[model samples]
Target chain A: MAQNQSAPDATRRSERSRRAIYDAALALVAEVGYPKTTIEGIASRAGVGKQTIYRWWSSKADVLLEAFLDLSGQAAEAAAQDRPSADASPYGIPDTGDLAADLKHVLRATVDELRDPAFEAPSRALAAEGVVNEELGRRFVATLLEPQLQLYVDRLRSAQEAGDVRPDLDPRIALELFVSPLAQRWLQYTGPITYEYTDTLVDYALNGLAPR
Target chain B: MAQNQSAPDATRRSERSRRAIYDAALALVAEVGYPKTTIEGIASRAGVGKQTIYRWWSSKADVLLEAFLDLSGQAAEAAAQDRPSADASPYGIPDTGDLAADLKHVLRATVDELRDPAFEAPSRALAAEGVVNEELGRRFVATLLEPQLQLYVDRLRSAQEAGDVRPDLDPRIALELFVSPLAQRWLQYTGPITYEYTDTLVDYALNGLAPR
Candidate 1:
């Protein structure tokens, strides 16, 4: 009885420390940016020993990547709660037999997430660092961004199968027509991001600019 | 006679110094990145006094902006040499009667420019900094990027007039479907960039994904 009770207590303690570490990593990266954010700083902010963070993560980049993944998962969960019947898997884009509508739906949610203060600051910091740091930028793309893009690829492939998209077009490149424009606007502040804007992107992307 | 001779000589010397300063500024930013680059460093690398740089520009950002403009002009001139009859003005995309061919032509040139090592490093450094630095990022977009985008806007407007494009679609947003993808790929290292890739982007953008 004593051993079982201690095991539960130990697991709870580990969980709390893990959450604290993630919070600290996100907060520090947002405050000081990636270059200045250190493992020691994260540990200190979390009120945990350096060994605790080391035991879980190999580097600050590793910690930030995991923290961001956790944050994205939480955002997806919250978004799912808003529409209980919608697919909750963060790994896939929903396919309701309407490609344009589905893309606009997800992109609008992305606009909201990008606008959120909690997500924006840290994300900007990491994205900025990745721009100058080639290795980090590639890793960020490979680990975080590519996975999200692949969802679009899958959706586009389904559309192609349904004869909704052109059979000759590559899905990866086809998706960029709509997806990249929104990303560029958000990343560079080139234009205002709104539901109206994203919806327009979907429409333009589906139909050629030339008279059809 | 002496004064006239000296005047031209002085002008030549000033022009040489200006070019050298531009080179130094580009190299320093590319090497050490935006934050570490300073007026003193640029001057030192150019073998000029710091006062010289201060006299010509108000800040490092000012120097960089001008340097990039000069580099772009030089690139355009070089590209113009390749196609002697092509419009050399960097301010507008060529509107040869065939919209698809004209857009593809320009995007192919852009692919070459983006691949240039001399242009790539410094441009990437500045662009990366802009991602995280809100004020700088806005300035970079407003001054450097938006002007280039406006050229596409002009070409698209011409297309609309000729019935090549639908009258209802906003030219500004429509251009992003093609432009932003190339920009995102170059900036993020998300994928390979080639003339073939840009040509495909043009084809996809002009024709809607849905079958006619």
Candidate 2:
């Protein structure tokens, strides 16, 4: 009976240690960026042995990726909880019959996510590295960016089936009309991103650039 | 009369030195990246003293910026010559009265420019630095990116007057739907760029995402 009780305590302790490691990894990456982040640095900051980090993840990139994934999931969950009406899908965008409204809703949430302090620094570090590092750039986009973009593709497909979007339009390219503008504004500091900017993008994209 | 001939020779030598400095600055940035590039290194590569660089430009940033502008001007001139048509304007996009075709033509040129090996490496170095360096990023966007983007804005304004685009749309933001998509694809390695891809972006931006 005592061993059984001790097992649960040990599990709790392990979980706590894992969280601390993730937090350290994220903070280190943000503070010093990707190239400077090391396993020893994360281990020291987390107050765990270097062996402890290695036991869980193979490399600094792995730790950082998982930490970011966790951070994004938490932010999404928090946003979803704050607004009960929000379409909270872990795997995809909400398929509300109104495609424009659904897209705008998701993009607005994305604005919040971009503004979130927890997500900003680490993401910027990764993004900056990806700018010059071709291998990392491809992997990061494949694993992180493409998945999110695919959600838009799926949503557009649904829009096509519903007759809201033109069947002839390639959803991949069509999604960029609304998506890439906000992304460029955020990445390049080209302009301010607000609900107003995103909303305008939707309207312009839905209606067309030319006179209707 | 001898002194007058010497004056012409001196002017030609100065022009050669200036071109050599610009070439060195771009080549160093591409080789070592932005952070590692220094005025001293540029000077050494140019076969001039560091003081010579300081005499002409205040900082490495200034040198790199001017170098890039000169490079882009050469590329544009080359592209213009390659075309069988009349002279292309240095200041604005072609406004051939056919808005879609003109936009597609310009964007295709941009696709070629981005893909050019001579432009790619140095550009990536500066762009990577821009991701983390806000002041430099803003400066680059203002001087280099914004000015080029404005040419599109001018073209779109003309389109609006011609009833090709809706007057209600913000051309600045409307332009991004097509422009930013290409930029993002190049900067992030998110997708492949081709004449076909840019052509599709033009169509989507000109038309609505919804059924016409």
Candidate 3:
């Protein structure tokens, strides 16, 4: 009975330490950027030993990737909770039989998230590093970004089956029409991101910029 | 005779120093990135006095911006010389009556420019800095990027006037359908950039993704 009680207490302690490490990693990355962000700094900030960080994650990159993944998962969950549907998957786009509406809805949520202070600073720092560091960029894309992009691919494939999108359209490339515009605006400050802007992107992408 | 002889020599020396400075600035930015690149470094690398750089350009940002502008101008001039027309503006897109063909041709050339090692490294460094620094990003966009995007707006406007594009579409936003995809791929390594990829983007952007 004492061993069982000790197991639960130890599990709770580990979970608390994990959360603290994630917070520290994110804060350090945001403050100092990717290059200056170190495993030692994260450990010091989290009030844990350097060995504690190594025990859980091998590198600063690994710590950051997991922290970001956790943060994004929480954001998706929060967004899901805000919706009317009880069955919405946190990472999935709504397939409400209207491809344009669904895309616009998800994109609008993205606009809000991009503006959020919690998400913006660290994401910009990591993304800025990725632009110059090809190895890290590929890893970030493969692990974090690609999974999110695949969600759109899945949605587009379903749209193809439902006759909402062109059957011959490569879902991967087709999704870039609306998605890439918003990304460029956020990443490059090329333009403002608003619901109206995203809505226009959907309309132009679906109807074509050329006369239909 | 003495003054006339020295005038041409002085002009030639000034021109050589300017080119050397530009080359040095670009190389330093490419090697060490923006934040670490300094006037002293550029001066030392160019074999010129710090005062010489200050005599012409106000800051390192100014020096780098002008260097990039000069490099881009030379590249644009080379591209213009390759074209069939003697009248093509280096900064302007070709306005063949067939809009799709013209846009594809230019984007293909852009793909070539993007792959150039001399262009890629310095551009990536500057762009990465711009991602994190909004002030510099805005200035970079205004000076270097927006002017290029304006060329697209001009072409699209012409397409609209000729009844090739929808009369109601905003040209600025409309151009992003194709342009932003290429930008995102190049900036993020999200996908492979090829003539085929850019060509397909043009087709999808011009034609609706929905079944006609």
Candidate 4:
């Protein structure tokens, strides 16, 4: 009975330590960038032993990836809470049977997330490092970015089944039509990222620039 | 006669030094990246005094920007040489009356340029720095990227005049439908960049994703 009672307490303590480590990892990466951020630095910042971090994560990259995943997951959950009846599946884009409206809705949420200070700094730091580090860039895309992009693919495929999107179009590339522009704007600050801008992107992407 | 002859020699010498400096700057930036690349390093590599670089340019950023400009100009000239009678005008996209054809042609050329070894490394280095550095990012876009985007705007406007494109659409946003996807793929390693990929982007942008 004593051992069993201690197990639950230990699990709760481990969970708290994990959250603290993730927070430290993100904050350090945001402030110092990927190259300068270290596992030791994260442990020191989190007030945990370096051994504790090593037990949970293999490297700084591993810690950072998990940190970002947690951050995005929290953001998604918060967003879902805002729209109670919305598809709240953290892994999927909502399909409300209105392709354009659904895309615009998701994109607008993305704009909000991109603008959030907690999300923006570390994301920019990691993205900047990814730009030059081909290996890291590919890893980031595969681990963090590709999963999100696949959500768009699933949404597009559904749209195709409903005859909202052309069956012949590659969903992967088709999604880039609306997605990349907003991403470029946020990543490069190439333009203002607003709901209106994303709405226009969805409209122009669904309907060709060429006259009908 | 002696002074006049010496003046021409001096001009030729200056031009050679300018080319060497540009080459050195690009190579240094590519190797060490933007943060570590310095005016002294560029001058040393170019076999010129540091004073010579500062005499002509204000900072490392200034020298790097001009170096990129010169490299792109050379790339454009080489691309033009391949298509003897093509637009060849570095400042404009060809308006061949078929909006789809013209856009596809330009994007294919862009794919070639982005894939060029000489262009890719230094461009990626600079672009990587720009991602985290907001001031530099804005300057890079304004100086290097925005000018290229404007050519598309000009082409789209001409298409609008011809009634090939919708008159109500904003050319700026419309251009992003094709351009940003290519940029994101190239910058982020999100996917393979091919002539076929760019061709698809042009098609998807000009013809709606939805059925005709």
Candidate 5:
């Protein structure tokens, strides 16, 4: 019984330390951005030794990636709470069988996430770093961005099966019609993102801009 | 006659200095990126005084913007040489009455531009700055990006009048389907770009991503 209790306590302690580390890493990255954020800074701010961070993660990039992943999970949980189904994750695009509606829903949620202060600062920092660092840019795209984009691919594939999307269309490129526009607007500050704007993108994408 | 010849000589010298300044600004931005690129640095590298840059432009961003504008004009002129029609701009999207083909052609040119080593470095530098800095970001979008995007808007508007595009579709948002995807991929390293990829994007945008 004592061993079992000690195991749980240890797990709880580990969880606490992990959360603290994540918080520190996110805060430091937001404040100073990726170029200046260091392992030592995160460890110091988290009240953990730098060795402790090294024991768990190889680099600041690793720590930040994990932190961002955790943040995404948390955002999903927050998003899930609003939906009727308890089992659904808010992390992926909704497949409510209406492709346009589902896409619009996901894109709007993305807009909200982009606007959220909790998500914005660290995201901006990582994004700014990605702009200058090719290796990190590719790695982040592969790990974070590609997976999220794959959700769209999956949705588009489902649409293809249902005969909702063109059979000849590449799901990857097709998804970008509605998706990348929002991303470019957000990432590049090219335009305002209203629910109206995203909704309009869905409509324009679904009907050829040419007379259908 | 001698005075007229001397005036032409002065003009040529000034033009040479201006070109040198533009080259230096582009090189500095590529080397150090936007935030670190300084007017003094551009001046030293151009072999011109800081006052010379100040006389022409108020800030490094101004100088860089003009440099990009000049570069874009040069690229357009180079592209123009390959065109069959004497009347058509090599820089302008061909209005061949087939909206899809015209869009694909222009996007393919953009794919080449995005991939070009000469264009990539400084373009990336300005784009990276646009991601984090709102003032410069907005200005770059307005001055440089919006103008290029507007050209697409113009072409789309023409397509609309020709009954090629839906009368109801907003050309501005409609253009985003093909345009923003390429922009996002280039800015974020989201994916590899190719003529095939751009062709696919044009096809997807021209037809509803949904089954026609």
Candidate 6:
């Protein structure tokens, strides 16, 4: 019956299973933490066979990483749904000729995403694990976090080229002034995250704190 | 014999036991994490009675918090020992009237402290737990992180008065522009932490990312 199925039917079924697996993985990690999340558990929760998970992902880490990436994509897509260019990649920030507005917009969306309960619990669990587990932490950063940070880097680079940013400063470090503050506040509960806070961050970052 | 002991002798014995308990609590948290590390465990490892720990700190959280504070104090003391005035408060940053230099000096010391193995392991463990545990995270920030940040706030306030910083800016948020970057790097393994990196953070934060 499987062999006789149409390719489109098979594709639809595969997509469904992948989504289910991702959901299961996120839920399991949120409830049980990373070290205890197993492929078998994910498979059971996903209503798929263990071989189905094994065929796709070699380890639980792989499954979780992909699941997180998928989740991030969904968050980004939701955030960008109202943008002017619907076909534009959700992974990149909008270049609206105004660095401050663009950054604030992205950060505000990040604030929303960070607060969403569906994202928060699993993200906190994974992030908590990453804090102590250096090897996994690096992998998580490399795979999930860095690419997102790179969006800021890319935006800053564009700002540099447009004369909106200081040409001499490193874009990588420059991006951190706004991004890391929000991240720390979110990760450590150091402060509140709000659109106002993020907007202020952009203002402070764009204008020198030493009396213009 | 207990009643025969002089005041100073009894104080010395108590201090020794307190130090031992702090060390044990830190070590246990580093090894077994926040949930698994217990009051009995710290007492056993420290070679002190469980009642002794209970007499001072009510829970493992209390013990770990004090341990971290003590460790931070030691780090600051070691970092500031080269100062001209030996009596200067170790918790406060140096104010040579140059805000940038003073900040660089403090941040560089922080770089050294974050890299210290004794502080690094236990701090990471607690930080990891705090990420997932909101109540603990807030407590950690309020007790451990906020006080350290207040040092920066104090420094920034002084700088504002001296016309070195914009008086309108909030010192608490302004400090995060530099501090949170180093924190994020250390916590998430997103980037390398070094004296040079922190120095750059201070520079970028004060000058703003946009052109002068």
- Winner on DockQ (1 vs 3): 3
Q: Give the TM-score of chain A in candidate 1.
A: 0.96
lDDT of 5 by residue, A1-212 (tens): 99989999989988998999999999999888787899999999999999989989999999999999899888878877776673235666777778888888878888899999888988887887787788888887887789989988888888889988888887888888888999888888888988999999998888767665
Clashing pairs in 1: A207-B208, A208-B207, A208-B208
Could you tell me which 10 consecutive residues in candidate 3 chain B have the lowest summed lDDT? B82-91
Kindly report which residue pairs in candidate 6 clash with one another.
Answer: none
Q: What is the fnat value (0 to 1) for candidate 5?
A: 0.81
User: Which tens-of-lDDT digit does each residue in A1-212 have in candidate 3?
Assistant: 99999999999999999999999999999998899999999999999999999998999999999999999989998999888684347679888888898899999999999999999999999999999999888888888888888999999899899998999999999999999999999888999999999999999999898786
- Residue-level lDDT tens digits of model 2 in B1-212: 99999999988987888899999999999998888899989999999888878888999999999999999889878877766565348545777788888899889999999999999999988987887788998888987899889888889998999999999888999999899999999989988999999999999889888998
Where does the lowest 10-residue lDDT sum fall in candidate 3 chain A?
A82-91
Task: Give the DockQ of candidate 3.
Answer: 0.86
Deviation of model 6 at B132, angstroms:
0.4
**Candidate 3: lDDT of B21?**
99
How accurate locally is residue A8 in candidate 1, as Cα lDDT from 0 to 100?
Answer: 88
Quick one: ranking by DockQ, best first? Answer: 4, 6, 3, 2, 1, 5
lDDT of each: 0.89, 0.87, 0.92, 0.91, 0.86, 0.90
TM-score order, best first, reads: 3, 4, 1, 6, 2, 5
lDDT string for model 1 (A74-168, tens) is 99788777754766364567788888888998898888999999999999888888877889989989988888899888888889999999899
lDDT string for model 5 (B1-212, tens) is 99989999989988998999999999999998887899999999999999988988998989999999999999888877766684345667788787888888788888888888889999988987777787888998898889889889889888889988888888888888999998888877888888988888887788777766
Would candidate 4 be rated incorrect, acceptable, medium or high by CAPRI criteria? Answer: high
* Per-residue lDDT of model 4, residues B1-212, tens digit only: 99989999999999999999999999999999998999999999999999999889999999999889888888777767766375636546776678888889889999989988999999999998898899999988998889889989989999999999999999999999999999999989999999899999999998989998
Q: For residues B12-57, could you state the per-residue lDDT of candidate 3 as single tens digits? A: 9999999999999999999999999999999999999999999999
User: Model 3 misses residue A115 by how many Å?
Assistant: 0.4
User: Fraction of the real A/B interface contacts present in each candidate?
Assistant: 0.89, 0.86, 0.78, 0.89, 0.81, 0.87
RMSD of each: 1.6, 1.8, 1.1, 1.4, 2.0, 1.9
Candidate 6 residue-wise lDDT, B96-170, digit = tens? 888998899888888888898999999999999999889999999999999999999999999999999998999
Candidate 3: count the clashes.
0
Q: Give the Å shift of residue B39 in candidate 3.
A: 0.4
Best of the candidates, lDDT? 3
